[model samples]
Target: MNEEVGSLHERLARLEQLLTAAQRKPAEPAWRRPTSRESRWAVSAAVLGAVALQLLLPERLAFHPEWLLPALELLLLVLLFPGPRARKRRTTSLLRGGGLTLAGTVSVANGWSAVLLIRGLVRGSEGSDARTLLTAAAAIWLTNVIVFALWYWEWDRGGPVARAEGIADYPDFLFPQMQSRELTQADWEPAFADYLYVSFTNATAFSPTDTMPLSRWAKLLMGVQALISLLILALVVARSVNIFGG
Candidate 1:
């Protein structure tokens, strides 16, 4: 009886050791690795382009004083860029928060401009000059592309940093290169410019082209972008054409 009790205690101790070892093991990553991180230069240039585009919009279509939104966007960019080398996690969260804030600000301003443009057209209050109307519509269309591109860049695979870290097991957008290792390098991953191209293509085609949206949010965003692009083309561009013809 004494020998049996000792053996039982030994087995229990071994089981506990196994359990502890299992708990200490790190989780295995489900996806391929060695993803190259994207540079911030492209993103910064895109944001600056958005700011310039906002400035091109008509005064009535822009925020009061016309420069207010641009100034705010510039300020956010100034604060958000130059991410710290240390304190990586905290700085990443801060940068993401600031990036989303900047993107949201631009989205709101552009949305406001879109709404006002549509309202003015419906109410017949917008200027009748074809050139000015066309220019403004073009600016809005270009801004729309940049805004959606920013969203895609920031959201795909839990943002750029997350992608670089290979934290996400899957991607939100499926580029052709991701489908096959033969198409590109083993370390190939979507970058900000890729998202921008996707946005531009989606806006032009009013649908996904080569790249496909794999997530619900991606599909919804593309749908909204299509709707807005359609509205700008159908209403604003059409009105400008009619004015020119008249």
Candidate 2:
């Protein structure tokens, strides 16, 4: 009888252990840590888009000489592609710094334009031509999307290099695939395109939609982007409509 009791207890303990391990297994991340760095092609394209948008703006809205900002941005972009033989750590740091600087410069230029445009609108001196106003508004709106996408790509999870190295145990942005791991492949990782999509949705919806911001900085950034988008739509678009109607 005692021998039977011992065997029954041992079986119950073994069963409990299996249950615990099974529960833990499901809690583990479904995706694998990224082994390689993300590609820069998307980022490069986004920067180019921002540059083009800046060029498209009216000369009055653009900085003096109009080409200075884009020229400086292009110069910084060159730093992003260093010599192949450069040390890996140094290269990564340089690329991150250069990218941030380039994005910041674009952002500052766009912001200056936005301020000037708003000032002109308020003073009843700008956007007199509906077509010109609409065109300038579209350019600013698109540039806003591109620059925010760059910010999201560069800041998430301590930037792309850190993300590739698996330094951040948790993501700054909580993508839908991250939550619904079963829906995505094991090797899935967020890329520049993903960030761009997030930026686009946030700008359009004026709030986070599918992918949510998990960090304070992410929330703040999204909020600022939404505010800028709102200002452009409400002020510039409305002014254009008024001009056309009148």
What's the number of clashes in each of the models? 0, 0
lDDT score, candidate 1: 0.86
**What local lDDT score does residue 218 receive in model 1, on the 0 to 100 scale?**
97
The residue ranges of model 2 lying beyond 4 angstroms of the native Cα positions read 6-12, 15-32, 82-87
Residue-level error in angstroms, candidate 2, position 112? 0.9
Which 10-residue window of candidate 1 scores lowest in summed lDDT? 27-36
For residue 115, model 1's alpha carbon misses the true position, in angstroms, by: 1.1
Residue-level lDDT of model 2, residues 1-246, one tens digit each, is: 999999999999999999989877454453336556676777888888899999999999998878889999988877675522353787777777887888899999899898898889888899888889889988988999999998998899888777766778667899988877789876678999999999999999999999999899999999999999998888987787788788
lDDT of model 1, residue 172: 88
Q: Write one digit per residue (lDDT tens) for candidate 1, span 171-244.
A: 78988887776868777878889999999999999999999999999999999999999988888866776777
What are the models' TM-scores?
0.84, 0.89
Model 1 per-residue lDDT at 132 = 84
Mark the regions of model 1 whose C-alpha exceeds 4 Å error after superposition: 1-34, 84-87
Clash pairs, candidate 2, are none
